[model samples]
Target: METRYDFVIVGSGVSGGYLAGLLVKSGAKCLLLEAGKSLNPKSFPLSPMDLHTQSSWGGGVEFSRQGNLSLYRAKCLGGGSVVSQALVDRVDNEILEDWAEITEVEAFKPSNFSNYYDTVEAVLRPYEIPRDAWNRNAEIYLKGFEREEYYWKPVKRAAHDCQDSAKSSDCIVCLGGCPRDSKYNSLTRSILPAIQAGLEVQSEVEVQTFQEKQDHVEISARDKNGALTHYQTHHLVLAAGSFGTTEILLRSGLKKYLPALGTNVSCHPQFVSFGMFEEIVDAHRMAFSAVTSNDSKLRRLGVKMDSIGIDPVFVSMLLPGARKSLLKNLAHYRNLASISVSLRDESNGNLSLDRSGRLQFDKPTAPKDRHRIQQGLNLSRNFLLAAGAKSLLPKTQIFGLYLAGGCSLGTDLKTSVVSPQFKLHGSQRVSVTDASLFPSAPGTYPSLTIMATTQLAYEHLRKPV
Candidate 1:
C-alpha cells in the first residue's frame, strides 16, 4: 500500500469534495476516501413505480438517538447533495456575524462565503420551478396558503430540464436520486472537477483510525478487499458528514481528549403535514424544495415548510401511512399530498459509540420544541383542510435529531472541539471541514455552508502545504 500522501481527506460529500477540488487545483497531492458507492444519475428511475430494494431507506446507516427509525441519507459518491432537497439558501448574514464574533474567528465573513456560494450555485445550475409543472399537491398547497395570505415564497432549487410529467412529481425521484440529472450531486460537479485536478478519490475505502506521529499523522483504512491499509500524511482534512466524521473520531478514541467532541450532535428536525387534497396535486412536478413559508410566526414557533415530494417509503415513514384509514386516504395520492414541513428545531442531541467504535445518537426533545411541532401540525392541518383535504395526518420524517455542534468552534476548547479555522483541539495538520464543524445548526440547508467552509479551510491548507 502507498503509506504516504501529501493530504488525506475523509468523506467525499460536500465539504470533502470542495476541499479536494481546492487542494488538487493548488497542485497538492491529496487522497479522498468515502464509505459509499458512486451512482449514475442516468440509472435512476423516472416514476413512483421506480422503487424497491437498494432503497435509500433500506440498509442505510441512520444516526437518530430519538428511538425513531433511522432516516435515509446518501451512502453514495455525491453524498446527500445527491439525495438532498437541493435547497441552497445563503447563511443569514446576522447568523454568520454572530458565530464569528462568538468564536473569535473573523474569517466567517459573509462576503467571503457568499462568493463561494455563488460559484457553487452557478456550477450546480440552480433555477426556480414553473407553476404549471408543480405537482397537483403543490398547486393545492399554493391555493390554500395563498387564500390565507400566507407569506410563503417559492424556494430556490438546484435543477435542470424539468420536463412536465403528468405521471411524475417535479422532483419525483429526488430522494432516490434525481432521474433527470437536474439535481446536483457532487459526483458530477465537485468530485468530477477535483478528479479532473488529478486528486485521487477511492470509494469503498473506510478509514479506521489515525495516530499522531513525528511531524505526520498515520491513517489506516480497509480497502475494497477489506484488507487494512495505512496512509501517512503531513495534513488531514475531515469533511465527513456529521455522522461519518463523529464515528471516525470516536473510533480514533480522540473524543476522550476532546470532551465536547460528540456531545451536541443535532440536525434539522423535519415533520410532514399530510394534506390529502381532492385533486391530483402532482406534488412531484416542480423541484424538491420549490417553496417556503415566510411566516416568522412559524419560525418563532420553530416549525417551517419547504417544497417537498412523497414516495410511498417516505410516505409510509413520515405520514400516517401504516394506518388502514391513512392507506385508504393515500389511495388518492394522485390528488392528495402537498408540501413538507422541514423544521429547524432547537433541540439538543448527542452522539455516542460502542466499545467497537460503532456510532449511535440519542436526544429527547423538550416540550418547547414539541409544542412547536404541534403548532406546525395545526397549521398544516388547517391548510390541508382549506385545500379540501379529507384528513390531514401529520408525521415526522426527522427523528427530531438534527445533529450539530459535535466540533463547534469557539474561543476556548471547553466550549469547542476545534478552532475557528477547524483545526482540531490538539493537532496542527488535522482539520474538520464538514457539518460536524458547524458552530451551530444552520436554519436552512447546509450544502452551501459546507462548501464555503471548505474553501476557507483549503485556503489555509494551501498556505502551508
Candidate 2:
C-alpha cells in the first residue's frame, strides 16, 4: 500500500525545494524527489576539480549536440544554488514586458511581478557586493569600465557574512560549495525547513516517468539501489530544471499530446576572454563576479559583460591555443584576468531524445546571437586593452549555465507546454514551475527570477481553480 501524498515534486532544485517548503507550510503532504545525493556544508567539495566533477550532471562537462557549447547543470540536493555564486537579479522591466507580450500573461509584467520578486528577495536576503570587498581583479574591471566610460554596478548575491577581505580565498571555495553556510541555498533556507515541517525527501531517486490518472498521478522512479519504485500523488510537480524536466516529459511520450513539449529552448550562452596583465591579478582570491556591466546600449543589444574569477582548471580549458603555446599561456596563470560576455539569444532551439533515449538538443548559435556575441567580445577586448592587458586569449568555447525553456507558459496549447496557470496543457494534475516555464530568455541572471516565479506559481496553486 503506497501512501499517496498531496504533492509529489520531482527535482529538488531551486524551484522544487522552495515549492515543497511552501506546500508543507500550508499543511500539504509533499514528497520531494532529487536524483542527486544530499550534501551538507561540511561535505561539499573543497577543490574546483572535485566540485565540478562531484556536484553536477555529467561531471559538469556535458556538451551540445553540435559540440560548439558546453552545458553545466548541478545535480546535487540544492541543485544550482549549491554550486552557483547565487547572484540574485530581477529581470529588467522591458524584458518582463516582452514576456507578457509573448505569453499573454499580464502577471509577468513588472507591475504585477514585482510582488513575487519582493517576496523572494525578502526570503533570500540578497546583498550587493560592497566596494570595500572588491579584489584586484574587480579593481581592474572597474578601471576598465571607467576608462571605457561604460556604466557598471556591483553584483548582488544571496549570501551573508562573507569574508570582507579579497585575500581570504574563501569565495573561491564557494564555487564548489560554501562551507561557512553563509550562502542561502534551498537546502538550508527551504528544503531543510520543509523536512522539519513533515515534508518527506527522497534523495538519489531518479524519476523515469509519470502517468496522470483520473484521480491521482503515478510516478515511477529508480532508487539509488537501482530498484524500481512507484509513488502516488494527488498532484505532480516537475521542477527538474530545463533539461531534466523536458527529458522526463519526452520519455513519457507526452510529446504526442503537447506539440511544444521540448521546443523553444534558450540558454544565455557565455564566452570567457582572458587578459594577461603585468601584475598578479589573483582573480580567484575573491568573489567570482563582483561587478556587472550596466551599459544601456549593451542591454539593448542583448549583451552583458562581467568580471569573472575562475579556478585554474577552468582557466586552462577556456584559454585558446594548444600544446606548448597552451602551457606557455598557463605559466602566466597568476597574472591572467578574465571577463565573460553573456548574450540574451534571440534564436530558439529544440530538445529531443536520441535513439538510445538520451537527451539531445539542437541549439546552434544564430547569426543574430553570433552578432551580439561578437559585439560583446569587441567591447570586452577594448576594456581589457584599456586595463593594461599585454595580450588577450579569446574564448575557445561557448558555455551556458542558465539553461531555460522547453515547457514554456502560454495560453496557446499549440505552441506551449504549460498553461498560464502553470499546469501542463493536456494534464489536469501535472504542473511545471521552474526554468522550464520560461517562454524566452530573460536576458539577466535568472536564479532570482526562477525563485520569484515559483513564488507566483505557489500563489496560483493555493487558489481555487
Candidate 3:
C-alpha cells in the first residue's frame, strides 16, 4: 500500500465501497480499510445455523427486545451487504423531508434524492422478483394478501438474474453470500470495480483513531497481528455503519467535542409470525420476502410486514419446544409460512463504551413502541387466520436489519456529529458517509437509501477539497 492517498475510507461496506468506486472513477487515489477478513464467496455458508463467527460479531447479530432488536451487521470486507438479503427500497418523500429539515440541507429534498436514486439504480440494476419464481411459501403470502384486500408491492432486489436461483432453493443462501453470484452486494459490484480502478483495500485492519492535520489526516489502525500502523490521507471517510463508526469516534475522544457522537442510535425493532398450513409450504425454497405490505393499518402503527422464509435449523430455534416438540416442528418445517413485522419506533437508544472499551448499547423499547409492536402482531395474527392458517405462532422480538443514527447529521453540532456535507461538524478533513449520519431509523429497508446517501456525499466530496 502507498504511504499517502487522496482519500482513505475506514469501512468497506456499501457506503465505503460505493464511494470508493466513485472516487476511483474520478481518478482519485483511494484506500479502503476493513475491520473483518476478506470473504471467499465460493465457501459462503449455505445453512442458517452455519455461524461464520469470525466474519461477524456474535454471528453478526444482536437480540435486544427493549433495545436493538435482532440486529445483524456484518463485520466483513463488504460489510452488511455481504450478508444482507439485498432488499432495495427508495426513501419515501416524507422521510426525506424530515431528513432535510433536520440536516438543514437541500440535498435531502425529494427531487435531489430522486436523481441519486436513478444513478444508484442504474449502477445496481435492482429488479423485482418475477411471479413465476415465487416459492410455494411466498405464493401463499401473495394469495393471502390479495384475499385480505391488503395493499402489497413486489420487493425489488439488487441482483442481475435471480430467476433461475429463485426457482431453486439457492436463494436461501443469501445470508452469508450469494452462491449463484446473482445478488449485487458491494463485494462483487462496487469494491471489486474500485479495486480494478486502482483503489487499494486493506482487510482485517481495524481503525482505532484519526487525527486531522493541516495537510492530511492521520489514521491509526491495528492489523490482525496486533501491530499498529499509521497512514495519512488528504480526506478520511467513515462508513463503518452506526456501531462501528460511533465506537471509533468515541474511542478517539471526539465524543468530548461532539456531544452527540453516540447518542440516539435507532434500530427498527422487528418480530416474526408463523402461519401453519395444512399443505406443504417448504419455506426454504426462498428464504426471503418477495413482497411487503402497504396496508393502512400498518401505516398507522408505523409498521411493515413481509413474507419470510427460514431453514430447518433456524426454525428449530424459533419453535417452542423441548426435544420432542422441536423435532416435531423440524419435521413439519415445509408446512409453515411466515411474516415478519418491522416497526418504525419512536424510541431511540444510546451507544457507549464499557469500562473495558467494549461498546455497550442502551435502547429501551418504550411502552408506545411495545404497543405498536403488539398492534402489528395482532394484525398479523388476524391476517394469518384469514389466510386459512390452522395455527399461528408469534415469534420473539428482534432488531430489524436496518440500523441508523449514532453519528447523526444536523445543523447543530450540540445535537449531531456531521454536517450537511457529511463532514464532521468541527473538522475539515474528516467525514462520515454511513448510516451513522442518519438522523433517525428509517421505516423501510436501508441498503438502497444508504447507497443513495453515499452517492450524494461523493458528488460533494468530488469537488476540490
Candidate 4:
C-alpha cells in the first residue's frame, strides 16, 4: 500500500516552501515533491570562484521533453530560488488594480497583502539598498529614474550579510547557487522549518502525474532509476512555478478540464546595458538586483532596473568574447558597469505538452506582446542614455530564462487556468500558488507579490485553526 499524505505539494520554491511551512506548522500532514534534485546547504558551492557553466544556479538545465528547450533553473533542491536574484520588489498598486481588472476577480489589493509582505520581509531579512551599494553603472541609472520621476524605490533584497556582495557583482553564485551562502533561498528558511515541524519532506522524487478520486489525489512519480513511485494525498497544491506546475497537470490529462491552462503566460524580456567607462567598475564584485528603478518609471516604460554584480560570466554577457581583451577593461572593470532592464512584458505566450508530455514553447507571441517588447526596448535604451551609458544592447537568449508565465488564473473559468481565489477551477483538490496565476504580469520584480498572494492562497484553503 502506498503511503498517503494529507497534502502533497508539487515544487519547493517560494510558494511551495512558504506554504509547506505554514501547513506543517498548523499540524497538517504534508508531502512536498520537487521535480529537481535536492540540495543541502553544507554541500552547496557558494562562491562564484567555484562555479561552472553547468552550475545549478545559472547552470544549464535538461528539459524533460524532446524538441523542448532546456532552460536554466537551479533544479537542485531549492529550485530557481537557489540561483535567482534575491529581489523582493512588491507589486505596484496600479498593476495590482490592473490584475483585478483583467482577471475580473476581487481581493488582490496591495494593502490587503501589506501584512503578508511585512511578514515575509521580516523572515527573509530583506535589507534596504544602501546608497553605497550602488555601483557606478547602477548609480547612473538611479539618477536617471530620479530625474524622470519614475516611481523608483530602492529594491529590497532577500539575504543577510550581503554588504560585501552588494559592493561587487560577484554575487553570481547566488543566481546559480551562492558560493558564500549569503542568500536566503526559501528552501533554507521556509521548507527547513516545515521539516523541523515534523513534515515529511522527500527529495529526488519526480512527480509525473496525479489523479482525483472522490476526496483524495493519487499521485504517480518516479525514483532516480525512473522506477514508479506513488503518493496519496487528501489535498494537493501545485506551486511548481508556472512552467513545471502546468506540465504535470497536462501530463495527468487535467489540462483537458481547463482550456486556458497553457495560455496567458508572461516573461520579462531582460537585456543588459553595458557602459565603457574611464575606470574599472568591477560591479560584479558583489550582489545582484539590490538597487532598482522605481516601479512607476518601470511600468510607464515597461522595464525595471536591477543593480548587477560584474563577474566573468556577466562580463561574458556584457562584452561577449572580450575576455582576454579585458585587461584594458579590467583596469576599468572596477570602473566599467552595467544594469539589467527587465521589461514588464504584455505579450502572453504558451507552453504545451508535445505528443510525449514534454514541455514545448508554442512560439505563440501575439502582436500585442510583441509590441510590449518593443516598448520595453525603447524605454531601456532611453534609460541607458539617461545613465550616461556609451553602449547598450540586450545580452541573453542562451538560457532563455525570461520569467515565463503559465497556468494563469482569473474569475472566468473559460479564460484562465484557475479562479480569482487561487483555486484550480476544474480540479477539486488542486490550487496553483505560483507566479503563473498573475493576470497581467507585474511591471517589475515579482517575488514579493507572488509570495504575498501565495499567503492569501493558503489562507483561502487553510483548514481553520
Best-matching candidate per lDDT: 2
* Candidate 3 lDDT tens digits, 1-465: 248899999988888888888899999999999998887577776666663465666664565534435566788878888888788888668889999898897888998789888988997788887777667767777677778788888888898766534546666677777777777878888898778889899999999988898999999999989999999999999999998999889998888889988887887877778888999887778546688997776777799988878666556644556697667666777788888888887888888888998887887778999889888888777777787889876465465567788999998988899988789998889989999888977789888889989998887899878
Stretch of 10 with least lDDT, candidate 1 = 49-58
Top model by TM-score, which number? 2
Q: List the candidate 3 regions with Cα displacement exceeding 4 Å.
A: 51-54, 63-68, 164-167, 317-325
Q: Write the per-residue lDDT of candidate 4 for residues 396-417, one digit (tens) a residue.
A: 3322344546777776767888
Q: Residues 151-198, candidate 2, lDDT per residue (tens digit)?
A: 999999999987746546767778777999888878889999889899
Query: How much lDDT does candidate 4 score?
Result: 0.67
Query: TM-scores, in order shown?
Result: 0.91, 0.98, 0.95, 0.86
| Candidate 1: clashing residue pairs, number | 26
Better of 1 and 3 by lDDT: 3
Model 1 per-residue lDDT tens digits across residues 160-200 = 66564444534556765777776665666767878877888
When 1 and 4 are scored with TM-score, the better candidate is: 1
By TM-score, rank the candidates, best first: 2, 3, 1, 4
TM-score of 3: 0.95
**Model 4 clashing-pair count:** 41
Candidate 4 displacement at residue 256 in angstroms: 2.0
Q: What lDDT is obtained when candidate 3 is compared to the true structure?
A: 0.81
Residue runs of model 2 more than 4 Å from their true location after superposition: none
lDDT (CA) for every model shown? Answer: 0.69, 0.88, 0.81, 0.67
